[model samples]
Target: MNRRDNAPGASADIGAALYGLATRAARRLPRDMSLTSAATLATLDRTGPRRITDLAAVEGITQPAMTTLVRVMEKSGLVERRGDASDKRVTLVCLTEAGASYVRTRRQAGVHAFERLISELTGDEVEALVAALPALKHLADLESQDREGQNQ
Candidate 1:
C-alpha cells in the first residue's frame, strides 16, 4: 500500500506546504548570494570558528572544496584563518566583521520576507503558524541531534 494511504496523521501535506512557504519566501527575498556561502557564514556565526575539516563535515562538503571556499572568503575579506591556541598545527576558519555583518543582513532579509508573508495571512492562519513554532523548533533540534549522532 502507498504510504499516504496509511494514516490521516501523516505529515505529507504539512511538509509540502512548509516547503512551498519556504521556497516562496526565499524567492521573494532580495539577495544575490549563494546558499552555500550564506550557510557557511551562518554556521561560523552560530558555532564560532572551527577547523576546515569540521566545517566540511558540518556542511557535507569535501575538505578540499571547503578549503577553496575558505580561500575565496578570505580573499573577499569575509573570513580569516587563525592558529588554534591549543594546537599550533591546526588552522581555524573565522568570520571577519564583514562576514558576520553579511550574515546578519542575509538573516534580516529572510525575516523581512517572512514578515511580509505573515502580514498577508489571515489572523487564524497566522495563529496557526505561531502555534506551530514549537513543533518546528523541535524538528530543528531533532535534525541537529541526528547530525551529531552521525558525526559520532
Candidate 2:
C-alpha cells in the first residue's frame, strides 16, 4: 500500500503543524508594518519593480488597497513609484535603499531566531529538519509557481 494512502490525515496534520510553527515564528518579528507591507517589499526585492496591480494580485489584495499601501510605503521612504521605462503610463513600485536594508535586517533577525530555536533541538531532531529542508523548499516553490500562474 502507498504510505500516503495508509495515512489518511497525515497531510492535514503536517499542514497544521507547519502553520503553528510559522505563526510562532512570525510573532518574533517586529510589528512595525503589516504582513502585506513586508510581503510587498520582499516581492520588490526579489523581482525588482512591479506595478501596483501586480503587487496587489501577488499579495492577494485589491488594486486600491495596493495603491494605498504604496502611498504609505512611499511616505515611509521604503518604496518609490517611478514611470515604467517602456510604458510611461504604467508606474512601478521600486524598493528604496532603506527598504532593502529593512528586508535584510528582518531576514537576519528571523534567521537568528530560528537558529536559537534550532539549537535547542537534539542532534537527531536537527538532522530531521535538515533532511526535510528540500521538501519544504519544494513546497515553497510550488506555492510560488501557483501564485505566478494565478497572476498570469
Candidate 3:
C-alpha cells in the first residue's frame, strides 16, 4: 500500500495538492475580470434569477456588497433587475444576454487555460482528470446545498 493510504492527514494533503493545481491554472488566466464578477455571473447562470439576498448568501458575501456588484454589472449592461412578480417588495437579478455571453467567454478562457495544462500531463493523468470531473461537480453541489441549508 502507498504510504499516503496509511497516513492520518493524507486526505488533507491530497485536497491541498488538487487545490494548488487548480489555483495555478486559474492564475495563468488574464486578470481583466475580477473573480467576484465571474463567480456572480456563473452563479446566476447555474441557478437562474435570484433575489439579491439569495445571491449574496450563495456567493458568501454581504447583501450590501452584492448590491454594489449588481450595480456595477448593471452599469456594464450585463445584468438587470426587476421587481419580483409575487413579492413586489423584492427584486430579482437576472443576467442579460450580454452577461450570458460574458460568462461563456470567461468559461472558455478558463477552459483554454486548463487545456494548456492538460497538454503537459500524461495520457493517464488526463483520463484521471476527466474521471474526476463528475465527482468534483457533485462535491460542489453538495457544498452549496449545505450552505443553503445553514442559511435557512
Candidate 4:
C-alpha cells in the first residue's frame, strides 16, 4: 500500500525478515526430532499417506534415506507402512495414532509460541499482524499448491 512497497528488493526484504523471524522462533522451541522427520510427519498429516519415493521427492532427499527414516519411525511407532489399497505392489507410509497425536501436540506448541510472542507486541503491531494473517495464509496456500503441482 505504501510507495516503497513496490520498490526493487522489497520482496526479498520481506522474505529475509520473515525467514529470520521464523528461524529465531524455531531455535527457541524444543527439538524432539530432526527437521526432516518433523517435515515427513507434517507431510503425512497434511496430505495423507504417501509413497516413500514421493515423500523423498517432496522432501528433496534420497529414496534410500527416506526408507531409513521411515524404518526408524516405524520402529518407534510413529509411522507405519501399509500396502496401497489400489495397488498391492506399492507401499504407502501413514501416520499412526501416536504420530497424529504428535503432530497435533507439535502444532499446538507452535501456536502457543506464536501467541506468546504476539502478546509482547504493541497494539498497532498486533493489529498489523492480525490484518496480515490472511495474506500470510494465502502465501502458504500458494506454496502448497506449487508443491502439489511438483508432486504431480
Q: List model 2 lDDT by residue over 1-152, tens digit each.
A: 87779889998999999999999988878999998999899989988999999999999999999999999999999999999999889989999999999999999999999899999999999999999999999988998899889998
Per-candidate clashes come to: 0, 0, 0, 0
* Candidate 1, superposed: residue stretches over 4 Å from native: 1-9, 27-31
Best by lDDT: 2
Q: Which clashing pairs does model 3 show? A: none
Task: Give one digit per residue, the lDDT tens place, for model 1 in 9-102.
Answer: 5777878887997788667655666667677888899889999998888888899999998998899999999999999999999999999998
Candidate with the greatest TM-score versus the true structure: 2
Q: What lDDT does model 1 reach? A: 0.85
Candidates 2 and 3 compared: the better one by TM-score is 2
- RMSD each, Å: 3.3, 1.6, 3.1, 2.3
> Which lDDT tens digits does candidate 4 get at residues 32-73?
788899889999999999999999999989999999999999
What local lDDT does model 1 show for residue 42? 82
Q: What's model 4's TM-score?
A: 0.92
Score each candidate by Cα lDDT: 0.85, 0.94, 0.87, 0.92
TM-score of 3: 0.83
Q: Is candidate 2 or candidate 4 better by TM-score?
A: 2
Off by over 4 Å in 2: 1-3
lDDT of 2 at 64: 99
